[model samples]
Target: MKPSIEYLQDAIEKLGVENDSKAAAALKISKQAICSYRSGERIMDDFTCIMVAKTLGIDGMEVIAAAQMEREKNEERREIWADFRKKFGVKAGIAGLAAALTLGSLAPSKANASNLELGAISCLESPVKLYIMSNLAWGGFSSKQQKCW
Candidate 1:
């Protein structure tokens, strides 16, 4: 399971700051909040998770799930959040793989024909999967698409 502190640490590191105070300033939070997060006294809120995700260039849902899991007291609830994290992680990995394959196919080489086909398949498959999952989860496509884009 990905910890919320790991996300906080990654955000600070990505900002190239050596101290918590500077990280707090960059993150728009008090140093005490940073300390609380680092010390595991507090879990990041959804907004803060989104901020961290933006800083780390990853999906906000993954960070939000991690934070939610960290904050949950019930084992069952925590497991649900963990499941969300796993799903989001898989989605991010697939998106990354698809992007890599797509970019690789862009390279000038006849040998990349098969890769281009695979990339195209992945590109189409990812959205279809996402659409199906979103429909099942939310019961409609309109809201999710609006929020995601």
Candidate 2:
């Protein structure tokens, strides 16, 4: 079972939300992530937990412990990118990507629904619609249902 959205909601509340910017401010992450975390669709990561705790002036270890009991929680998700690269070779435009990250974490699948979305169109074969999607280090982008040709 995962922690309830209320857990994050409570954490947010502890920080004393500014109301109007709740959603926008939280957009420091993806809307899907916020919704998923808040709705219990996914668990909060350690970075988020720590942020919440720090904003609330509480202890991170304590929050993580409580969060863990209700969810299959883990620490930061930065490791997911490295793991993805190890599992699947980076196709294109990934040369300086890992270097651009400030938090040492890669952003989610960036190129989508555009020319770059499919990488090199000619690189793909005819008679098959091809699109290149990066694995979002965390839960957004919904790559779970996709099957590449």
Candidate 3:
């Protein structure tokens, strides 16, 4: 509905695409991308629309809802995935922005990445977290006594 340039910009920044090149690189788009979108010369695809909507925390159905069955089936899955990946996205965004600004790794998927399909977080992945869990489980550790005592 509201496809203003300012709205597009806000959406772009919120999605961690704070600049033209970064936006183009991340979305595999081109310099004409934002211009086209803003000038009504081109239409953004479904995925970008969803991405923008999710990042901006806005209603995508303002145009057209994906579909009833797909919506119902994917809603829960999306929520769970969002919660888990939020932190990763934030960290990746920060590092990614630095890299992008420095003309380093523009795209994250190109460098020896694979799909692990993990359902849970690993311990070594976050030591501080697992350390707290370990302490809670073992009650306490006495380095001076050099024993569980």
Candidate 4:
């Protein structure tokens, strides 16, 4: 699990808040709570993790699971939380990739329009096309027949 301070810093940076006090206000928490999170004296609660995730535009479950893992005392329960984090993180990544692909396909260029048609056909034909397209879009090698749509 990532440290609470890291999450706090990320929220502060991503929210463009000037200080911990401002971040606390934005997150609807006390400044002292922010200080406790920064000092690792306390892990964020589920609500705070959700707020952080919303601020970061990430999956709330991923952040919640990470916090749960950090707070769990039992090793087995910690592992469960870890598993939840991994699962939700992958789902969130896939959703992000899908959104990017959809946006790219919306470009006004004719070439992109053609790719959009190809992508629609591929989606109808095989779910595996999503995996291939995501890889190619991220700079993976692709054959002419496997071009990312």
**lDDT, model 1:** 0.82
Of models 1 and 3, which has the larger TM-score?
1
User: Which stretches in model 3 have alpha-carbon errors above 4 Å?
Assistant: 4-7, 15-18, 63-149
Candidates' TM-scores? 0.70, 0.37, 0.33, 0.67
Per-residue lDDT of 1-149 in model 3, one digit per residue for the tens?
13334445676776685577787665556768767776666566556565555556655532123222123356787455445345544665787688776554232334544643232334335655334345645756567655644
- The reply for model 1, stretches above 4 Å from the true place, is 110-149
Worst 10 residues of 3 by lDDT: 62-71
Give lDDT: candidate 3, residue 97: 83
lDDT tens digits by residue: candidate 2, 1-149: 21335546775666576652474265355666776776566777777777666665655654464455455334344344334334333432253464565323322254453434343443344567779875665654555555441
lDDT of each: 0.82, 0.53, 0.53, 0.78
**Evaluation by lDDT, superior candidate among 1 and 3:** 1
Candidate number with greatest TM-score? 1
The CA lDDT at 59 in model 4 is 71
Ranking by TM-score: 1, 4, 2, 3
Model 4 over residues 29-134: C-alpha lDDT tens digits?
9999888888888999988988998898877777777778888999999888788777776787898999998977656456645455544543456655334345
How does residue 13 of candidate 3 score in lDDT?
75
